[model samples]
Target: MRIAVAGGTGVVGRHVVAAVERAGHEAVVLSRGRGVDVATGSGLDAALEGVDAVVDTLNVTSLREKVATEFFTTTSRHLVAAGVRAGVGHHVLLSIVGIDRASGYGYYRAKLAQEEVVRAGDLPWSVVRATQFHEFPGQVLGQVPGPVGIMPRMRCRPVAAAEVGTYLAEVAAGPARGQAPEIAGPREEQMADMARRLLRARGRRRWVLPVDFPGAGAAFRGGALLPDGEGPRGSVTFDEWLSASQA
Candidate 1:
């Protein structure tokens, strides 16, 4: 089987590619670095030729709803249309678990729009909604830099990016189930605490300010990011992952 990973060089995308190749499938990387621009579908059709499945792990770094929505919707539309023309069998999309409940967040709303675009498309699809990855806190901290790191006060069940990658590969190789089970971490952790721990693990001392923001922050603080469904869960805890990652 041939599997094309849309964000094949990304954090999760790299793991997906490794997992797919380890499973004895050809991994076609669809990225600008590989000459395939999935964001606009410019080089997608030729790249998707003879591809059996496509896993969209594409990511955009924007907190604005319009920007995120446009990126996701455009990439999703192009992928679906190209997959149909290329005769791809399965289309797997990586999404967050609580986008439906946490639409208060701009990025979540954009993700919801992207999911809608996927479902409305003519391709056989599956949506794997996972919780935040263990790297989420670090990502958040990097977005806003200061002498003290700003950490949002939120509860989350964070999984390993590698585990999500493996799950995506398995799903892509199978029949599309449309809204596949959500993947989450084994336990929930506070994002603010996680941020502090991350900084500490790096042997750095920086004050982390935990703020309970309104709207999206409220939803996150209210535990909207916690997975309610009994889905596939990773075995690695945050501390365990942190320990290994830091080592």
Candidate 2:
């Protein structure tokens, strides 16, 4: 199988590419760096010339609803249309768990729109909703400034990006299931605690402050972002991830 991975150079996308190759399948990367932009539909038709399946892990870093929604909707439309043209069979989309329950966040709202676009399209599609990645704590730390790192007071079952990648690859290798089971970490965890542990593992001494984020913070704190239903869960814990990062 020849799998085309949109945003193949990204964090999770890289693992998707690796998983595809590890499974003895060819991986076609679609990214701006490779002259293929899913958002603008530039160089997409040719990039997906012989693609059998498409794993869309494309992402946009934005907190505004309009920007995020536009990016997701446009890219999804382009991918579906191009996939149809290229005779791609399976269109697997990587989405976040609890997106339906948490429309307060701009990014979540955008993801919901993306899912809708894929479902409404003509291609055979599957939606794999996964929880936040283990790296999310570190990412949140980087976004905040000052001597103290502010952590959002939220509960999450953060799965490993690599595990999610492997699951997505397997999904793409098979027929589309429309909506696949959600994926999450083995246990629930506090985002602030994860940040503290991560910092300690890095041998860095910094004050980690936990605070409720404005606007969408309530949704996260209210557990609207946690995974629902019986879904596949990752074995890697935040502690294990921290230990590995130090190695």
Candidate 3:
């Protein structure tokens, strides 16, 4: 099987590519860095040649609603159309678990729009909704902090991106399920505490103040983003992920 990873150079997408190859499938990396831009449909049709499935982990780091929506909508449309033309058998999309409930957030709104496009596309598709990654603590610390590293009050169940990647590969190899089961971490942790732990692991001493935000912040604090009922849980804990990073 030949699998095309649309954002193969990304944080989780890179691991998805590796997982696909490790599972004995040919992995093709599709990214703007490789002269293929999914958002613009550039080099997409050519890259779709011999592609059995497409795993879309493409992402844009923007808080702006229009920018986010445009990126996702355009990218998904191009990927699906090109996949149909190439006779690709399956289309797998990676999305956040709580996008449906938290559409007020700009990024989640884009993700939801992307989901709609995928569901309405001509190709058979699967949307794999996943919770936050343990690496998110690090990612957030860099983005949401001011003088000292602090995280706003929110609930989070952060899985390992590597685990998310593996799950994506598995879904890509199998027949499309339309909407796959949601994936999450083993346990839930407060965002501020997670940030503190990450800071401690990095040998930094700082106060992580937690602020209560309204709207989207309220949704996160209310646990809207945490996986409900049962979902697949990865084995690596936040501590485990940090230790491995050190090693």
The candidate that wins on lDDT is: 1
lDDT of 2 by residue, 160-237 (tens): 899999999999999999999998999899999898888888888889999976667888888877987988889998
lDDT of 2 at 159: 90
Whichever of 1 and 2 has more TM-score, that candidate is 1
* C-alpha TM-score for every candidate: 0.98, 0.96, 0.95
lDDT of 1 by residue, 138-204 (tens): 9988988876888888899999999999999999999999999999988889998999899999988
For model 2, state the Cα shift of residue 144 in Å.
1.9
What order do you get sorting by lDDT, best first? 1, 2, 3
Candidate 2: lDDT over CA atoms?
Answer: 0.91
Residue pairs clashing in model 3 are none
The model with the greater lDDT, 2 or 3, is: 2
- Give the poorly placed runs of model 3, Cα more than 4 Å off: 144-146
Q: Quantify all predictions' global Cα lDDT against the true fold.
A: 0.92, 0.91, 0.87
lDDT of 3: 0.87
lDDT of 3 by residue, 1-247 (tens): 9999988989999999999999999999998788897878989989999999999999888868899999999999999999999999999999998877776677788899999999999999999999988877677678765667656687878899999999999999999999788998877888888888778788877778787543487787888898875667888877788788867
By summed lDDT, the worst window of 10 consecutive residues in model 1 runs over 212-221
